[model samples]
Target: MKAFVVYCHPSEDSFTRHVRDSFIKGVVDSGNEYELSDLYKMNFQTDMTEKEYLRDSNYRTTPGLAEDVLAEQRKINSSDAIVFIYPVFWTDVPAKLKGWFDRVWTYGFAYGEKSMKLLQKGLVLCTTGHTKSELKKYKLLESMEKVMLGDRLFKKVHDAEFIVFDGMTKACDLREKNWNKNLETAYQKGKNLFAPRS
Candidate 1:
């Protein structure tokens, strides 16, 4: 299997980067091919230009997608599975990632007689400052899952999963305690990404 990993983090020094590396290691160890898009490293253009906006709004498929957007679309088409790795900000994906969806999931591609390929899997691995209990108490975790799985990835993949490595705040003791465990889970997820559904 080939997995396309979309990793978005501002710094390489962070734990999220380690999560990414560990996951990739698992993919490699599993004998699967992988492609990575390090959004921060690429300095991807997130903001939608007016022309791009008009194109989507008007439902016109005149074929003027920017090269960057087309490149991302191509990656999606070529992959067997898609994985998104990021850190939660304000209970949502980072603006950079949100903008990636806004810009790259273009008209006639992600929607409107879509050209986007339906991948075998869509997996999201996000780090959160709040503990899972805290997020569940307020139903924030459900909201995040609904947005990512029910909305953004709806009908786009055969199966989808949303996993959070929670309690990652610097001041939280669990951050250190669960660090290795969380990464092991991430690696396992990658290793088993293409396993048959049971």
Candidate 2:
């Protein structure tokens, strides 16, 4: 199986980057193929043109999506699984990623007479400064999962998972303590991504 990994982060000096690399290593070791879209490195055009906004808003099935958007759609359709890796920004994905959705999830593609394939799995691997307990206490974790799995990945993938790499800020002592452990988990997740779906 092949996985399309959408990695969004502004810096190379981040735990999230490590997570991406480690996971990819595991995927390679497991003999699975992958395609990567590093949004920042690609300088992805996230903002939608007025024409696009109007087309989607009107539910128009006009086939004039931007080249970048079409490329991403092709990636989605060609892969068996999809993975999103990023740091949580205000209990949500980064603005670039969110805009990716706005532009790529176009009419007659992601919605209305959709042509996007239904992948076997959709996975979210997010880094957060807040501890998991804090996220749970306030139910922010649920909100995050709902946005990604319930809404965006809903009906888009057969199964989904939301992974939290919590307490990852420099201010948190756990950052150093849990760094390797978290990366190990990421590697394992990728290594087993297409392992009979168990």
By lDDT, the best candidate is 2
Per-residue CA lDDT of model 1 for 19-77, tens digit only, reads 99999998999999999999989999989999999999999888979999999999999
- For all candidates in order, the CA lDDT equals 0.94, 0.95
List of clashing residue pairs for candidate 2: none
Error of 1 at 42 (Å): 0.3
TM-score for predicted model 1 compared with the true structure: 0.98
Candidate 1 ranges with C-alpha deviation above 4 Å: none
Q: Write the per-residue lDDT of candidate 2 for residues 7-76, one digit (tens) a residue.
A: 9999999999999999999899999999999999999987888999999999999877788999999999
Root-mean-square deviation (CA) per prediction: 0.8, 0.8
Off by over 4 Å in 2: none
